[model samples]
Target: MERRLIHVITPGDHYSPRTGSAVPTVVHGLSAHAPAGTEPTVLVARGTYPDRYTSADVVEYLPGTEPGRWDRRLDPLRGALGVRRASSRPWAAALHDQDEWPPSVVVLHNAPQAVPLVDTTRHAVVLYAHNELLRTYSPREAALTLGGVTAVVCVSDFLAERTRRRLPPALRDRVAVVRNGVDGTVFRPGRRDASAPLEVTFVGRTIAAKGPDVLLEAVALMDRDDVHVTIVGSSGFSATDPLTPYERRVRAAAEGLRDRVTIRPFLPREAVADQLATTDVVVVPSVWPEPFALTVLEGMAAGAAVVASRIGGIPEAVADGGTLVPPGDPRALADALQVLADSPDRLAAEQDRARRRAAERPWSVVSAELDALLAARLDGQVTA
Candidate 1:
């Protein structure tokens, strides 16, 4: 019997938590929990990493395919064109170098344009949609770019619908929803003391879109000294990355709260989980349409009550486990948080509900679903 091999490809450095994107984290979870019959390996652009093996065996890019120092200048342009970092041609050429035991199926994480780069005739190619990437692609362009893809797996139904709208009618049927997942065991809850102040934590990039500033604004509206808010993230993914004007503004606003607020730099996954474990409420105050936020799942699995903006795929993730406030509305967010802050019983109940809901969609479940999809593709059941 031939062994089924799956190559899970990341759009960026997979080994670093400082990469800031959730694609690497998602790839790690799916590969780590893959079903028994299939073998999964993570393939990524070459980068030196700290010694670790949290995911599947990782393979680096072939020598010539590795981006040169000067190639970094073209990243923005290449990314806008839906091509790979450096350029799509060299990376695509390197993918074909594996003729010995070529992958049975190639899974591209959050890189839609790379779909056509993989030879679908030799290997089944799946594009894992982590955001609204196809919006810029015209129907003709979408058709051309995704022409060779076996299937498109979206992280949420909300994202799936948006993806379908961008693709040509012929390819829309190939889009499927697999919903992003969390590792429940690693993010489990910690003991909380009701006598202490309500602990509110916001974890994500300190960008205007992610709305950490909005969280701070909400905290100001509440004006409760007993509610301690901790903002755990920087302007970007790296702790040493310089602060942007917007982040500086957020810091100034946080300064107004003085002892009530504590702003910290971006932390590793372990640190984030540790913080969430003790947090009473986790806020995802995104002002934009978030495709799907892993923070929501992580917070829920950590047994923290979640209060997020009711936009994009957030409601889908929140379901009945968390509270939703109007996007960019500090008054509404403050009211929502105040309701939980005033009632310890409600907070405890929400935390219980969050953990239970998170348990329903562990990384194991994602692995199982992906196994089914890969099997379908291998069986020639996935239509173009």
Candidate 2:
């Protein structure tokens, strides 16, 4: 494998070291560690995070009306692009003004606004799909934006299928699935603390789509007092903003289980891994379809039984490794919790299954897969 420059472009910041969001983490993961003879670089328009795992070369922030998703000023763009953050167009144009060598490949993550970059250089563009198509462009816009793209690498098969349907049939040929993976080394197993109470955790944003509310309801429904629940992550997108209304609602919902439930704010990736390591169960109760929840893989890597929503690409990861319940149903979630509670042996079996599944692929393995896809497309082979 000869060395090649790979560039990842995301509309929002790729954070310095703040590692809660899945997209930035994946970008950082790919950028931080490249296979033999490869160089990776990241470009972002806005990010306050300064301690990135990888060296971020692009950090030109632009002014914006508000923080987080649903900025009404760019509401139309969000409806079409499916990203909360604004475009990094200004910095991107400046970067490619051509004093520097253009990347051989450009990965556009969640920003349809930057699709114009395809014309800036001959670099093979990949529109990395991370969510359903509704948040992205319409069929015609998709065809126009992705006209010169080498491929549209989806985070999961569910998203892949949705993406294919979003474009014209001619453009559909470019769609493919490259499932998200976790860092096995950082999320590896730890000794189970049997002395500690049975710890279960729900890690992700506290948004309505994430279904933290359902998890809290399920926790309150569980009759057993031995369970210790921890909900890690805050409600808003900004790292420094006040608690969001959603977070307040979740807190009010968990009022009954105040003593048993611990609402933990978001921690560093290392700390999140530590939390997953000791946790007996990791719940991802997302009501909306998640393209791929990396936390599920991290939990499985840590030898924890994962309980996630059966929607979207989740089944691709949780299959036979843990449990899945219908989305937005607290009763179903409670029932699944009872299953884990009633049978420690069964939970252990699930954990074993998960650990084995997680071991099948590391972040490096996945990055290599992506690199191979890029190589194929760049070589004019379109059978992705």
Candidate 3:
């Protein structure tokens, strides 16, 4: 049997080696898993940053012509039309033009803003939901679009359940849970220095949903001078949006503890790994239900004693691999940090388990499962 060609559509500025978002990671993993002779193409929204992944084939859809580059805001009224227009350009045109060959599957990675124009091409359409679109959409709009989707791929069981709860009954059956996997090879644990003060790191967007405020508050409660926290990632949504509510709160929380709390813009992927190498513990105190916390998996892979709130897909990802605390509870988070900081023996034992847990979730294993699922869908053995 001939292998199937898979086309991925994402809202993300794709193929950046340094980008650590789940959509990009999934694309990379799928490319690595594609069978020989099976073509996999990614369609990404054009961005200001230059193309970073030279090796991977990409189709950049210039949504609009801003001075510096393409921005989503350019054609806000007809974003889906813009993506469809770009898809017909040289890069993606071949897929549609080739009469002898047609895409076996069309996978959408959170492009709800532009999903209306997605070309199904009589192939299986899978929309990977990384977050709740209903929360952002009006009731009628959510019902129409979400109901029309052929199949829904959720990153976590928690998210699947949540989505189902919100969706109309007719749309619930289309949802399927497919958890995200980590690159163990790159994120594995490194040798720790005993002399260094305990390093606690949080890597993610500086947004309210990420719970940066919760993290800072928890650190303040600890009141331990020896412990250090590093907050990495950008917050200001350009000059127009300015700082987000969560970013403002995080900034305010770090005021007095400026010496202990280090806030910096996003770092490259390798730099993030470098930070993880020296990290004693990684804290993910997300106040919202994270569909899947990729950073938690990264931290576990890097051998940090993971401390995260027991919410969303986090508990599913950690699964006895690391420390779990109640979300939004500063005292509980501080207590967990204090326990890890004060007891090296306990942290070491947990670190071993965390590493082992992370090692079990390799991209190869995940890709195999995805391939089989897609195959089943194509064979008509599975209903959307």
TM-score of each: 0.90, 0.87, 0.81
Q: Candidate 1: global Cα-lDDT?
A: 0.80
lDDT of 1 by residue, 174-217 (tens): 99889888988779989888888899999999989999888888
Which candidate, 1 or 3, would have the higher lDDT against the true structure?
1
Ranking by lDDT: 1, 2, 3
Best by lDDT: 1
**Candidates' lDDT values, in order?**
0.80, 0.73, 0.70
Q: Residue 37 CA error for candidate 2 (Å)?
A: 2.2
Model 2 C-alpha lDDT per residue in residues 1-384, reported as the tens digit of each score: 553444554444555555577777777667655666666656555444556665334534452333334443564565366443244344354245323554456667765555665553545567777767435457766666667777788888888887777788889888888888878878978887776667889988878999988988898889678788998887644446688888888888777786778887777788889888888999999998888888889999998988999998998877677788999999999998888777888878888989988887677778888878777767743211
Best by TM-score: 1
Candidate 2 lDDT: 0.73
Residue clash pairs of candidate 2: 3-37, 16-49, 16-51, 16-52, 17-51, 17-52, 80-136, 82-135
Please identify which of the two predictions, 1 or 2, would achieve the higher lDDT against the true structure: 1
lDDT of 3 by residue, 81-195 (tens): 3323232233333234333435455676764443444455545567778877545444344555555456777888998887787677777787787777787766867778877
- Model 3 sits at a Cα RMSD from the real structure of 5.3
Model 2 lDDT at residue 112: 52
